[model samples]
Target: MKEITIYLFLLFAGVITAQTGSGEYSIKNVDENTENSDFGASFYGEKMIVFASPKKGVSLVNEVWEENGQRFLELYSANITDNGELYNVRSLKGDVNTKYHEADATFSKDGKTVYFTRNNYYNKKLAKDKNQWNNLAMFKATVNENGEWVNIIPMPFNNVSYSVGHPALSPDGRTLYFISDMPGSLGKTDIYKVSIEEGGYGEPVNLGDKINSPSKEFSPYIDGDVIYFSSDRPGGFGKLDVYASKTDGSVFEPVLLNQPINSNADDFTFIINPNTRTGFFSSNRSGGKGDDDIYSFIEIKPVEFKCAQMITGIVRDKNTNMVINDANIILKDVEGNPIENLTVNNDGTFELHVLCETPYTIVGEKSGYNPQSKTFTTSNEAGKITKLTVLLGTGEIVENEIKPEGLPKELPEEIVKVRPSTYVVNIEPIYFELNSSYLTKEAKRELDKVVDLMNRYPNMIIESGSHTDSRGIEGYNLWLSDRRAKSTVNYIVNKGIDPTRITGKGYGESQLVNQCSDGVKCTEAEHAKNRRTEFVIIKM
Candidate 1:
């Protein structure tokens, strides 16, 4: 009784015939009598190729079905003419046939190579354990001279101990898409891709849950940014129908291929030829010769948008202007869109990728220097490299000005007298880290004050001093204080201050205003007050 039921089920499965019209298509001269012959895929404006079995062709028929049996499948290809007519139909040579079950072949856009799946069609006895009998492998072939394919190599990353098949190439040929039964798949079979990198194929990335369900989804083809694959999930025209997906950046969302395109049988392995509305695919449905056969369809082309643009620039000092290597450069879009920011190379050059036609604010910062900022807009018309040059200025100093604050009121009138030589001037604060020589924010603020004073007095020479608190050993404090004072002078020099009129000195612990000295316990704040850094205007 079970045998009889299986025979009836096999008998009900049918085939497809030649179809026409803008969106209508069919498989021609398909020998449906052979059950294994099915699922053909091709791109528009390219040769139509498929996997099907012939009764007496080069396709070897080793294993035969017993339910009113004698069904075999092999891979075949047909040259599609410009007018959408099929011609020069022939079976693909080498690695394509194994006297076993082999069919379902897809070609790259240039038609230089092919990726297809082949199961244990050669394994004769269907062991009691069906799981052990379902192992399949995916293979590839590159076209050689004389227009024949050679160099058949098995795909590396997508292969597994179980099965791997149904390969697709992206429009730009930068990605390889295929189906596999590897672990972590959402279904019995799932779609996956491996990026084409500089050295070789990159690691595989799964199509994720959106496209592959607990059911089966396979046969992936890429047109522009859209991915057209096949799936047997629910809500289709039939058993296993074709589905499409749109990819934005790195994300892909599935879109069902509805209506007359998908039917109540198994419709899959579809390819869309670029620039044309026509495409070639495969299906196993009723209304024709036998079990499974090839089919074709037509679809509208989709619009594509640009993703990003490249920007490059250099950072240099304004005074003794030299390129500052390894300086950090940040670019942010108006909405604060951030990408992988970069730093200046050893040669002081940096590059960044930003969205086109977007407003971006940039900030360049480095140690021991003031932060620089600028705003810029990027557009598609601009080339990959948009050059942005930046020059950092140093702190400034002023000369010949009266001391505004911190003056002694007890000084005699004669001592305080200007004598026509009192140069009123302000010194910019050279920033320093807490208890360290590293520059700080407060330091830069002091320098700005110095810059203002310089604009007021242009001819006075200025002297800067470095001092340290008495919390530590006098020797160490001396070196730290000296570095702090010199750093202050360097800041002013970089800020356009005249080097000839300025001097720096480190007092170490030699000078002290308060009684707090080494070994004298005091609060950090009090110690900090003792660690204070001060700058004085000598000749001004």
Candidate 2:
């Protein structure tokens, strides 16, 4: 019977992942009801969850169907703790539970109306299909003044020949999504939705290929723009991997979630709280207490962006082309207020953080070189770095003089032609952990300096070259290095540097600086030298 098939799928479709978003999560079984299956959980109230369970001696009705010697499914309520643990489990009161089946209940936004799946049974008579087995159907109920569900009625679309169940309501309660095997379905079972009007329900419309594959698609849940569901189609971790898709009107293209959300087992019936970014789902995967158990999860947060707008470059002697170390670099705002006094590094390089969309004047001078000043503006473009090369000439040291208020300063006499100097400076090598492109704290700190340099020299272009240790295969190392290079560049770009000013390349183990090549034993430090990132000036 179709009801039997649906129950069998619920028992088998078990899968899960521990985390889903910007925070770490701990998942655990709701309770120790290991002897019987418990799943298809949905939020009941603020701190309670209503789920379907088939534990022995819990059903109130006598006309129960048995599968594997287990009682038919019944709706139960349980209180969930803040830490995602379940306790105080009990069955639903009033006339909601029956002998045939009652499960997969979803509530309206107000929690006053409930739509659920169950067998078509009324007045102690079961609605059976041609094979003498009952067919699954959807029903609705509303809470009365006595806090009990009254006015229970079967959906108008229910039929004995075909099955229609798994009801999920939209946030506004204006639309309902469900799974059915009625005529014109794309597969054995496909998801269908209908508009709920004040008068009655509209005709069921198939969700189409974007959602319903030739393989069965069911257990539809919507939160904001995303629709979460389960599918047994190809390219999944197992028989039924939970999938999510961004809903654009009536269309959706689902993407299969990776482990540990999906395993080599069936998983379905997912529900979540969008505000807390946490929820529960059922999985028949290994390491559970029951045949199918409800597990809670929270999503893990990702790395935060910390890089800021920066400028960096070297100060050099124009005639001699020598690095000018310890240069007094003064940065001033557009109104001539001193912003910062920078100390040039030994390599004649200086880096400074600057505000975007503001103009600043930079004055660089060594004890013996003439003071050189340049004016530039930081653009509003994000993640861009400006570069600059201050070419100071040999001349009589100029003294700081204060002019009379409102007086024009004297201009310097024209000097003979002086050639601009050019020199190469090696940046500190960026190190990474083995076989990963993720930016380490140290790596980010180092790239922050580069961001300052690129911000200072707006017209300068740089190349990020990354290499890997020789421990892995050359091809794999190359791929890893490529990702590392891009990762490094992306970090700098995210700091407000222009992406066009930088490029990345991976050398793999082909450009080792030491004797840590393949087939050669070397110390970890030696191999580490090869796994490095370098920034070279490509254009100025």
All candidates' TM-scores? Answer: 0.47, 0.53
Model 2 scores a C-alpha lDDT of 0.73
Q: In model 2, what lDDT does residue 290 have?
A: 77
Best by lDDT: 2
lDDT of 1 at 351: 67
**Runs with alpha carbons beyond 4 Å of true place in candidate 1:** 1-36, 43-45, 58-68, 120-134, 158-160, 249-253, 300-540
RMSD (Å) per prediction: 27.5, 22.9
Listed per model in order, the count of residue pairs whose N, CA or C atoms clash below 3 Å is 17, 41
Error of 1 at 14 (Å): 17
Best by TM-score: 2
